[model samples]
Target chain A: MSRRTTLLTALGWLALAAALLGLAPALLSDFRLGLLAKYCCYAIAAVGIGLAWGRGGMLVLGQGLYFGLGGYAMAMHLKLTDAGPGQVPDFMVLYAGGEMPVWWEPFRSPVVTLLAILLLPVLVATVLGAAIFKRRVKGAYFAILSQALTAAFAILLIGQVKTTGGFNGLNNFQSFFGYSLYDPVNKRMLYFLAAGVLLASVALMAQLHRSRFGELLVATRDAEERVRFLGHDPANVKLVAYVLAAVLASVGGALFVPVVGIISPEDVGVGASIALVAGVALGGRASLFGPALGALLVGYAETSLSESFPGSWSYFQGGLFVVVVLLLPGGLAQALSALASVRHRVGGPPGGRRRRERPASDRTRPGPTTPQEVTA
Target chain B: MSVPGRDYLEVRGIRVEFDGFVAVDGVDLTLLQGQVHFLIGPNGAGKTTLVDALTGLVRATGLASYDNQNLLDRPSHAIVRLGIGRTFQTATVFEELTVLQNLDIAGGVHRRARSLLRRRRGVPERVHETLATIGLTEQADRPAGVLSHGQKQWLEIGMLLVQDARVMLLDEPVAGMSAEERRETGELLHRIGQERTIVVIEHDMDFVRDFADVVTVMSAGRVLAHGTVEEIRADPEVQRVYLGHTVEGVA
Candidate 1:
């Protein structure tokens, strides 16, 4: 990218960060702020999806597998910390009172819990993605496999009543890593944490988007056979994106536990996973900010629309998906770019800086990596 | 003819079967450097399947070795790393990427994963030279999908060139080219043919006769005749397989 474009992009991100991290606390209601924090967690995972599914062309239908891993890891530690030494968590005490399960013992250490949150999902995704990609199981077959695995994981969690709190999952944490959750200040800190993580993830994604690896990932998506003849292992390329997406989802899930104050099978099941993908498609999966913004839009819509109409939100979401896919295959981001270019043609000054080119998401040129590229 | 001790690709009894149908029966040929070797046969004579086996895109048995390394049974990607590349009958460049990106990716075989994540400093010297070689330097920034069909073919060939493929298997590269484009591609083959080995599967007899340094005729998955273009043109077996027709008549 030109130096000016790079500077403009960096400035755009800084302005967004100022709004999200510096100003949102003062602007939104506590309820809305908390909700935004939750949405930010989802955005983190969505950014990863953009890379893997959008750029790498791997339709990941079970990202909740990793999300659940991080959420449960955080929930376990919080629950254990809430219950003092040698004491069982309230849910376990109320249901199958005897001793803390052997597995729950490790989450007692904050370090261990954080480690588990980071490494466990990566471990699982590495194993699962390697197995799947190595076998060249892809497209709808891969999607079905991922979806089924998430379903089974949810079912397993529901069945483990004695250990995993069963269908109730894990909940009611009084503290988060020794910070009192009841305090408004700490809660706001948690929100800041989530927002900061989301922004950082976005910045990282922008770098990835313009990287040569990103170009290769798109190449692999378009022509896997041609990539092989180029002497590249397509599986490895895909695994990188898949595993990174898994890690991002895991981090999002970890933060989600504290922000939402709960972790359950319902939150990390096929429904949740597909909902995340829907948001990505709505925002433009191949775009750097599209996934994050799309996820936020979906989360916000679900909250507001579900409250107003109770049960109509699902139908509305379905309609939106169908319309966006059929009419705007590149999603809202592409439409935005299209609109900008049209405006430029009709009203822009002569010798305009912007070229009559396709959107950054579609082009592999050295343009701004952020969503601002639409305007740039 | 292959040099006695410097065979680039030596094949023996390479066969491919699907269920009970034999796609490619046991066949042997020696590909030598500095030559444009053409593989010509009737449809379903295993022209493509033979290339497929040699490139590890299909399951094949027997010895197909390059630089003493067996090409059979290795992964398709591993075969490419050993400096062998093949283009499909239809051009298969990454449509969404630019011409430069396509060649950059093809030439990036030697780059490690860590290095791939950084911004490309500039077009590598090799890619710049290849763009000029393929005459697509003007279209380097255009998305490959929007290129003309002939341009796409050149882009695919340019990709192999950037890949530094020592032995390239091209499947009907000029099948859909204009007369002028065909001539340019013929010159391209001869220009690069002096440094590498090339196996072109073509039905265009004029192209074959004009560019072939050697020709191997296949019939029913077997080598029916092997010699220079002139010798194969006069071979009686080739004549019979050509429906008792001449080379130009078959074309």
Candidate 2:
């Protein structure tokens, strides 16, 4: 990109972020602001999905596994805090016969909970990614493996009702770091916090998208054997992206608990995970803003649709996805490109010859969620 | 055949089996440094399979060593790290990347760091030099996928050159090219042969006659003849079973 284009893009992103960050507090009610905060957390995870699936082509279908890991860790810490000093969590006392599981003891410390939130998901993803990528597992097979992982994870959590709160999951937190949750002021603060984190995640990914390693990740996705022949391990390149995606999902999950005041198996199951990917696909997996904005829109639409139709909102969501897949294959990004081209036709000479002459073969392949070219 | 005191690539008793059939059976080969060796055979003659085994892309029991280090049983990527690079029978450049980016990535692989923040460009001097050698300097910014088939082949060769692999295993580098493209590729190989050992698997006998320093002809999973172009041509068994009318017309 030219220096002028790069500068314009940066400024555009900054202005957009500032507008988004200011809108909720200025216009929305406390409840609506909190709901937007929940969507922001989901958008954070969607950004990671864009990187891993859209750029790396890993199709991470089990991000819920990492999200749940971070959510549960944060919930455990909060539950312990609500129980007060040296007391077992109320749910544990009531459900686990008044004895806190020895495992939950360390989470009483904020430090350990935060560390586990950051490290546990990454650790799990690294071990899983290494084993899978090393064996050259990819495509739909990888998708199945990840979906199975999320299913099994949900089942395990459900079975541990006493410790995990089972089907009900964990909720009803009174405070976050001793700030009263009942205070509307503190509630809005959480929304800003989530917005700030989401913005930061976008910036981090933008940097990564420009880096050499980022380019290597895209190359590995397009041609694994050629990447191997180039003297760099494709598996390692993929593993790094997978681990980063897992970390992002984990961070999103951690933030989710305080903002939404709920962390349940339903929120981290196969359906939920697929919903996350659907948002990315709907938005344009290759575009930088597509995943996050798509996720927020999906969340908003789901809430609004469900309010109107109650039980049949899922059908509308499914129909929207189908429309995007069949007509706008590049998701909303393609629509944006089409609009820009139409504008150019109305105002300018027919653009560059290379852009005009790109073959249909190039268009047939799936575009990477990033700005890389379509593979042949 | 073993050549004493030579310490480059050595292969002995290499065998590749699939189910109950043998693809490459009990093949022994040796290579010296900086020699351009060509492996030629008819269709299904196990030439490509032997290259796969040599590069650790397939499982085989054999003493495959390069620079006294065992290349056998090692993964393909590890073999590349051991100063051995390869190109596929069909060109396998990352179609999404530009020509310069392709050569840059290949050249930068060795210098890559594990740090997330370490930003660097592709190896500039080497990539520019390789682009000139392959005559794709003008198309440096074009995506590899947009190039013609023959240019893609040259780009793959450029990739191997940029990687600086001591031993380059090019599989059918000129399989689908015009006569002029084939001649250009032959000249490119001849030039590259000055600094590296290249084991090319090709069916083009004319290209082999023009560029091969040593020729190994195989038929039905066995080495039928191994010698210079004239020596292999004179071997009756190779002529009768493998080359037949093909060599007479080409030579």
Candidate 3:
């Protein structure tokens, strides 16, 4: 890495730390802070989506499936614990007429719930990835398959009304590990925890992007046949990346439950998956910080818009997406770069010669190609 | 080091059919350890198809074995793990990756549980050595996409070297090369043949005549002749099928 890149990376992390831990709670209201906490969870999922869909060329539209699995797992444990040992949870009686489901028994223990949150999504992704990648089902076929999985997962969860809490979904949790979530201090603590986890996940992703495995993953995505001929199994490499992305999404979902205090089939359905993808696209999918920023901004916009114009928020969101897509194909990051260039042109050395040289060098720098073209 | 009674590659009446159109038909060939075997044929003569079948990129109907192991049922990656490396007719390198990184990926890593937890080690030196051998050491840091056509071919061969497979299958390794580059590549293949079995598919008759220990000529999805260049040159069927139809001064 160059000295300039090193310094920029360090400064970026420092800024992120300050924004999450130092600035968020001080500037926002309690409700807004809670919303930001929810955004952090979304940001986590977006990061995984960016890696799999953007860099690895997987087009994983079903990240919400993993997210839901993790959230429901944690929610089950929380509901069970809140209800105490012998008695059934209140939602069972209210929603399902007092019949406790057999499948929900495993999640009574915190350890089992946590493990399930991490492992279940990975296992599912492994099987799905192996099945699809081995057959060289890629491009539109892969995208459709993954989207179908998401739709199936959501429908399955919705159909399992008794066990999964159904369309209304799992909610009305009173406490999390005896911390009385109604307490503002506990809410703030959850916010901090979300921020901390988001930071760690970003750091981990950054490390992965720089590693040899990352290089191979991108290469496999770009030219599957070439990588295969080079003696590396493209399927296996894609599987690793897919599983990692799934696990990360699951973790994000697990944290999202406590932070947002509810989750539903609707939240993990096909529409939700598309929303996640849109955020990544709007933020610059290949960029390190793009997904996180995009997710947070989208989340914030959703909440504020719903409050300001409850019936028209979706239309506004749709319009915003269109404008962003039209104006910034490379996402907000590229827009920022363009803005910086304009500023430089306005303020820098007077003669147009130096300005002319800038764009020429920029053109020579090789803009990021699509994941498929990257290795071809 | 040729092992006693151990042929590097053994194909017995292998046939590959794509949707009932035979691409490689009943071809029998063997590559002994530490020898350069050349496959020379016209376009669509099943030279690439044969290489594809050997590397498990495409399935074959008949018995195909490598180093005494059954290769007909194995997956392409499993075939690679069983010590077979291959390159495509068109130059295929990781365009985004530097030349060194491309070699490193080709050099298989020890799988410790899942690949996510595994670390790639000791590949840099191997990559460097392969780069030096292929005369690409000065351009090791350059992206593979930007290399000259001849350089890209060398880089790919370097990738095959780093893979450390007992058998290397190269399809048209000197395609699109300048005359000088083709000569250099012929010499490089000669050097690599000492360490591993090399099966090269080429249309260039001069390159095959200069480098091949034995030439397997294919036409119409089958092996037409298998012998020394002079022996193949004297075959009437080969002359009628190939040399007889060729334009003058092409070779």
Candidate 1 per-residue lDDT over residues B1-251, each given as its tens digit: 33443347899999999998998889999888898999998888899999999998899998998877898979999999999989999999877677888888888898977898897778999999999999999999877878989899989889999999999999999998999999999999899888899999989999898889999999889999999988998888898988853354365
Give candidate 2's TM-score. Answer: 0.94
Q: What is the C-alpha lDDT of each candidate?
A: 0.87, 0.84, 0.81
The better-scoring model by TM-score among 1 and 3 is: 1
Model 2 misplaced stretches (Cα beyond 4 Å): A1-5, A350-376, B1-7, B115-123, B243-251
By DockQ, is 1 or 3 better? 1
| lDDT tens digits, residue span B64-164, model 2 | 87767778878888888888988887888888777887787787656747543444444478888999999999999877888999999999989888888
Per-model TM-score, in order, reads: 0.93, 0.94, 0.91
- What is candidate 1's lDDT per residue for A274-374, written digit by digit as tens? 88988998999887788999999999999999999999987988888777766766778778877877777678766655544434434543222343221
Number of the top-ranking candidate, with DockQ as the measure: 1
lDDT of 3 by residue, B41-143 (tens): 7777888888888878788888877667888888787888787888887888877677777787786543433453344444467777898899988887777
Residue B119 local lDDT, model 3:
43
Please write out the lDDT profile of model 3 over residues A1-376, one tens digit for every residue.
3358657766887899899999988999998899899999988899898788666877787888999988989999899998899768887887778889788888888889989999999888898889998888887778888889989988998898888888988898989888999999999999998889888878777767656677777777667777776556788888888898898889889999988888899888887887787787778767778878898888888888888888887687677667666666567877777788889999998887978777654543323533333222
CA lDDT for candidate 2 = 0.84
Off-target runs (Cα >4 Å) in candidate 3 are A1-7, A320-329, A336-376, B1-7, B110-123, B248-250
